[model samples]
Target chain A: MATATIAGADVTVDEEGFMTEFSEWSEDIGSALAGQIGIDLSDAHWKVLNFVREDFQAQGETPTLRRVSKVGGVPTKELFQLFPKKPAKKMSYIAGVPKPHGCV
Target chain B: MKRLLILGAGTAGTMVANKLRPRLDERDWNITIVDQDETHYYQPGFLFLPFGGYSRADLEKPKRAFMPKGVNLIMGEIDLIEPEDNQVKLVDGTTLPYDYLVIATGTSPRPDETPGLDSDEWYKSVFDFYTIDGAEALAKKLETWEGGRLAINVIEMPIKCPVAPLEFIFLAEAYFAERGMSDQVELVYVTPLPGAFTKPVAARYLGEMLQERKIGLEADYMLEQVDTENSKLISYDEREVEYDLLVTIPVNMGADFVDRSGLGDELNHVPVDKHNFLSDAHDNIFAIGDAAALPTSKAGSVAHFAVDVFTENFLDYIEGLPMRGEFDGHANCFIESGRGKGMLIDFNYDTEPLPGKYPLPGVGPFSLLMETEANHWGKVMFKWMYWNILLPGRELPLPALMSMAGKIPEKVG
Candidate 1:
């Protein structure tokens, strides 16, 4: 399993998505993933990313865009900009869910 | 040369403008609305604002944005209403003559009505969620606060959205729990109402919920004054409740122009027939929403229903026909209880909230007087509906009249 840093939190990822531990991540891998999705590891961005991940974990399913919007207080468009491809799937990816079928 | 002039571009005034704008003949009759401010606030959303659930932008929009195209939006303070002359004087020294007038100028929070409430502790320990500023400020205070005794006080009765206090308490519990500070924070609810709610069944249910959540209840406490220096709210007969943080629903009073015009009752609300919504003081004038002293809840649903009736009645008057004695004082509200669940209540002048199925009879997606996750979704979804559907003068799928189709009839003697 490979790992990366997203929004200052260390995260592990396999061929599917996020893995469990921060220790598996390297600085280069973290910066590459951050570059793939144009977002800085700012505190505000971390707050939203962490909240969405936590909400998905508690609900045991991926959250819809509106649910993420309400809890994060971030506009859907701005949230979309942070995760260019399949924001919901990317949220799930960062949240440690297996990449769903048909998601790149 | 007949014209209609409406005052205050809040919920009530905006509804009247939209409802009548389509019905009135633009060539023969002109419609004008007046208000000092430019923005219209979605008040129900204000309850969520203090919890970082909403921001100022989400709660407000340009008042003119929602107003119908045919109506003239007059942005100015109303200096006086000369009812005898059928004229309204604006602060800009302009006199507007009207053949008929609709006073929809709603109420304002009077925190100063209680002694020392507006003192040094005004926005510090003591706060109100009625205004944008108050809600935003309270949000900041709630963020860092570790824990202490937190009291939600209703200074008196007849405040807009009566159930908001209870919602605040419910959401607060969820908020503290989310922040892992639930154990440190103590919750108390103080109100003049004899029970946790106005109705019996809901009251008992909500009161028990309060207990379950470890929230203290002090009912029938008529507030005398705020002893700010000591951080205590004192009641008549010298009873006192101390709080590290005090959130209050201040005394709500009607429009200032009503008092200026001497056309209102003790609280400056216009006297109108409780059923008909016609001004008792004048034949051509009408009042609706919170401005009208109706013996119903001062709520958005009430205004929506009242405007539905007012539209029909006004059309009858224009055609020189008899008025229909409709308007059953119907009001429906969804109460948010946090933790992804909520309760729905539907009642009117003659009926109180009773447990039953709603809108679909036995197959309801919503249950009255019962808490459910679907009801919570309904409450959250309403904000979108308010902005896109309700405010734009669009007709919704739901009927304006309260229906008993989903409700089981109460057993009677």
Candidate 2:
């Protein structure tokens, strides 16, 4: 775990560049994190990112793609379109949530 | 008298009951175990059945045979668990009240969860070996299946015996080779994980093994649906894998009654404290085996190890003493890599499998993370142990928590 600057704001991040502190995340910081990964933050993308952000707070862990699809009301196909390739990892990265675990 | 209600007399429930029956006074506690089926399946044998390694007869026995004499075995389907009322209702309209409840209703492979998976092609071109019927059907299919592209796909994860997919593909390669048709048949493993396994060291080792065998691995493919019309699998990313025959490990979920009872996660697995198997919502209720949503492989090995720790802690809990045992999510599995050789892996929640000997420091009759003939024999011998030692709640020679004694840790960059 190390401190890194994103969107001109300082935040703690893990070795994989995922933000460690969820409280350090904001709309501006999120957009910059997305920009670093070559993805622009759209409302469609925020829907997933926002859901992941809030769900992590409540669930005490990251929500799986199934949970995002089933409980968060986001279809998996569209999540793939919004984030591309690996939506679960990318969405959580932008949302400043821990990497989703447990065989998802 | 305090009634102890145990649901689904599978591995965890059976072990818990057997371990406690001899200890709990018959006068003070009324122990009752409920299940819809009377037969207890050797689920690990299901993987071997597809390879013609075991027959259906070798995998099943009367559930009551393994249970203790004093415990009441009730055969019925669970309709609902009213946690507030501390009672469970059966499908036959009988209500059973309890002072304590244990949900050992394990997870199952639900092929119908995925669309086009349960349609006309099911058991014809598409198959699953998770269930007894599926395993038997697949065995017959393999007996007559002409050589073609055989694709094994894992639709999702947290499936019981997570390593079975790798073992299936490996055994298939050997099976086809034995029949002199290895040249005609192509094997591919389609999985959601990015590599051959979840852990880094084991994944690298297993991934190399797959490459050496020339097995094609389509990684990180999140399955969306099966297109039976085209005889292909469609992913959420719009990638399609066409195959002559498909063996699928579908989305696994816990008993539906868990969801109906409102005491489960999205997959219907009960939310339990990882350390003690106690439910997060209710203190008196506990979930063991695949029913508990622990961040580990839902394997019978886990259930056994957990029952060991749970038994010790439970004995303390009933006496109003502080429960001492803490489970480390220990899991040990044997991977059949074809031939007469197999590999064994043992680790806990915090530690990944390392290359070493198990049980014994260096003289391990079993080697970890490497293939050996002894490991294969150890796996074969486990059947007798499961019936004689494990189910009877006899103490295993192995420790409940993982030990780092024999392991030589490697530094990977």
Candidate 3:
């Protein structure tokens, strides 16, 4: 049981530092979290974050990376450049969506 | 009565027991299989656990279920093998004498060997998918993890399932996109080899796949330590790669008893003739599967094919006749790419994996070295074949030796 103060709001997280409640996420909260990880969210980051959040809201499941590359209009190579490390988990964190089940 | 005692009742031992039970006369010969544990695991299932596709219940079964009824099953840890005395001593001070011995004990991931790999960060920020517990723990970690540099490093070479790391990263790419986080994570592959794989052709082909997926490959990396405080992997050459989450395949080695018995090579793998698996030091002892030091990839397919050849040669050797069978070190593996597609690779000791049809030369339902949905299904179906047909020692239509019938070798450049 861990909690992080983000954008003046206390958000719950698991031991691995993943947000426990999607409802507690906000743009300001994501920005605050991103700042801790040494990232300043640009338009590209928001584009993926918003798309993931909307998809999770509608389908109750996150879209696959292939889906993001093909349907979300982001090229595969560009996705790596944007995320720079682990894009799926980071994007879900900022978008206020749950982590994809199979991504490591 | 002659007693044939086999050590480590895993894949190779179990198949040998089942294959020889009826072949040997019950009156003159006694068969016994020894293992430290009663549980048998479908090891390939470990790959699917992190993906929410498998559970402990799906992969575990009783060891006795696969062992033939006539073969005696002994549950005890092996302490040492006294090849000079033709006996094996158990941890509990029991000695089993054997006229012929087969060692099927397999290799295991040894995170402890790497400095700082098993530190406080293990199972927290750093994890391995080779073990069931490690895979299960990672499943939970991935549940809530916000992405960072996900570095998949192979600390050394000669690890089990050489293609598995590639499959994992490929599957990860698909898994991340499915969650619409393709832009939030970076994928990096660090290896000790010079390329994406061991063989030249396969390495070049797989290296391109890595490029297509945008996964950075840091090849020829010899891990020196894991900097837990800073979250980085340091190589012997003083190079460093930082990561938020590190999934690694640690150094793999054979059973410790092999070392204790003074029957092992540098990695504790028993020194055996690559063609027959007969121990170079002892004519009556054979080491098969991951336990043997063969110049081929350590995989289930290799064990199956080796077992096929060893069973025939063993019969001849025990009867004081010339052994007729020779193993060519054939191995086949399915590479799982994301998006419901996969690729297959088949080769032997002399040949590198080449692109062509497998089994059928001109008209294969499955393509080799190329991605297809059919290849994915083949991988899915292999689990069934492993348990029922392969373990039970039932005959498979595939040849034990590598076939060049449909293989296409690259023309001289």
Docking quality level of the chain pair in candidate 1: incorrect
Q: B54-154 in candidate 2: lDDT tens per residue? A: 99999999999988989999999999999999999999999999999999999999988999998998999999999999999999999999889999999
Off by over 4 Å in 1: A1-104, B409-413
Candidate 2: regions farther than 4 A off: none
Off by over 4 Å in 3: A1-104
Candidate 3 chain B lDDT trough over 10 residues, lowest sum: B264-273
B123-242: candidate 1 lDDT, tens digit per residue: 888899999999999999998887899999997667788888999999999999988998899999998777798776678888988998999999867677888999998875357999
Clashing pairs in 1: A12-A19, B361-B406
Q: What's model 1's interface RMSD, roughly to a tenth of an angstrom?
A: 24.5
lDDT of 2 at B33: 96
**TM-score between candidate 2 chain A and the true chain A:** 0.95
Docking class of 3: incorrect
TM-score of chain A of each: 0.54, 0.95, 0.86
**Pairs with backbone N, CA or C atoms under 3 Å apart (clashes), candidate 2:** none
Best of the candidates, TM-score: 2
lDDT of 3 by residue, B236-269 (tens): 6668999999999998889999999999865787
Error of 1 at B410 (Å): 5.0
Worst 10 residues of 2 chain B by lDDT: B404-413
